[model samples]
Target: MSQPVMPAPIGKRGRAALGMDAQDLSTITERAGDGLRVLGLRFTNDRGCPAERFETLRARLGTSFEGIEIDSSPGNAAGIAPSAHAVLTVSLVDEPGHPTRVALDRVVAFLAEQLRH
Candidate 1:
């Protein structure tokens, strides 16, 4: 909805969900393709929990993200903490027969809810 800029650091609650402390985890909103918006959440310290944590996240996600693609991988970002980091990429595409942009806020909230446990 707005112009893309540098990734913004997520809040305390989100950081806690990601098993991060001190080191920054940030997110950026950008266009992926035609009418596809992507939210890139990047973090350095998963405390080695990416595998189990994200697997659980993926399972709990289920059909909540039916039309969206959420994935994580080892990567790095400029101006982000710790240099080497993991990226949680959420790609949202417009659905046929849908009348509005995908509810990205809901997707993020659902992730937080599923990850908290």
Candidate 2:
């Protein structure tokens, strides 16, 4: 007789698997206004690396600004893929145009630095 094979254990589902909850997601979504443009750097999806980075940046930036919103796409079927991408938009309460551009640049720079390590 042939022996039975056991299936592997599937990891946690969705963004929670990446260590994020509803509150976190809500906060980010609420913060993103009309002026901010979120820049997402590709990272590992198995561990929710992108979401983690976003949270980290949000914490570092403080709560004075409006907020950051994330729009993520579906994850790939492959194991621990990096296909998931998020668009973060920061709302502008002040003047538009130049001020918003400068803020966006700063946010991008911060994200880049975080991904460096």
Candidate 3:
């Protein structure tokens, strides 16, 4: 039986972002909720989290998972980390006829968006 390797604590920015949250990232999840779900994460190179590579995922979610609502916040903002992989925090709510699709359009489109001096 091969046990999966546990991930490291994270980089400097990851810790900083996780710390800003009072409850911390521990409160974040990725399971179906009572018509609602929230995902706030800082994607690190060490974690293999995707930033602008959710088109297929989004398309699948939109078509297969009907009535699923999603709200996303991805990037390094005030309380977020800088130069991290990608912060993909999303909230889903499946109410009545709302008419909406999951989108990851944020301040930074990709890691290259960050102007490194």
Candidate 4:
């Protein structure tokens, strides 16, 4: 069985964009109130995704997944995972034409719009 891996601890830029400070990310999550969560992702081959790709996704997500818990494992999926209120996945592998960029843009637009409400 593959052990679940925690995403990197939220960085300073992410926290700032999320309007959070030194407090624990989990604690921030607890106070978020029924926000969207990107949990239960299973990576491919039981191996972790590349750190650079993960960080890219994290940076792209910005405050979209802020205060929300995210979890991952080893599995597979298509290039994009779109949720009702957010973009759930990005192309972990680099592809021609840069579909990841488009996905990230959708994520930012969707969640930023949600935040306005």
- lDDT of each model, Cα atoms only? 0.31, 0.36, 0.27, 0.35
Instruction: List TM-score per model, in order.
Output: 0.24, 0.25, 0.22, 0.27
Best by lDDT: 2
The positional error of residue 117 in candidate 3, measured at the CA in angstroms, is: 50
Error of 3 at 51 (Å): 2.8
lDDT of 2 by residue, 1-117 (tens): 001011221333232232346687456545554333334332233233434444444553344232333222345332222333221222222334333344455576766865774
lDDT of 4 by residue, 1-116 (tens): 01123343255433223223436445545544355333222232223322333343345444433222222222213333322112233433345333333444445676587688
- Give the number of the best model, judged by TM-score: 4
RMSD of each: 14.7, 15.8, 16.4, 11.8
Better of 2 and 4 by TM-score: 4
lDDT agreement of model 1 with the native: 0.31
Q: Looking at candidate 2, what is the lDDT of residue 24?
A: 71
Selected candidate, larger lDDT, 2 vs 3? 2
Better of 3 and 4 by lDDT: 4
Q: What is the lDDT of residue 106 in candidate 2?
A: 58
Error of 4 at 52 (Å): 17
lDDT of 1 by residue, 1-117 (tens): 111111222443332243433232222111122222322232324332223333323343333213332222343222223322333222223553221123445556755865774
Error of 1 at 61 (Å): 2.5
What would the per-residue lDDT of candidate 3 be over residues 1-117, giving only the tens digit for each residue?
001112233554332222224343223322222222322232322233332223222332333222211222354232223233322332212233221111233223322343441
Ranking by lDDT: 2, 4, 1, 3
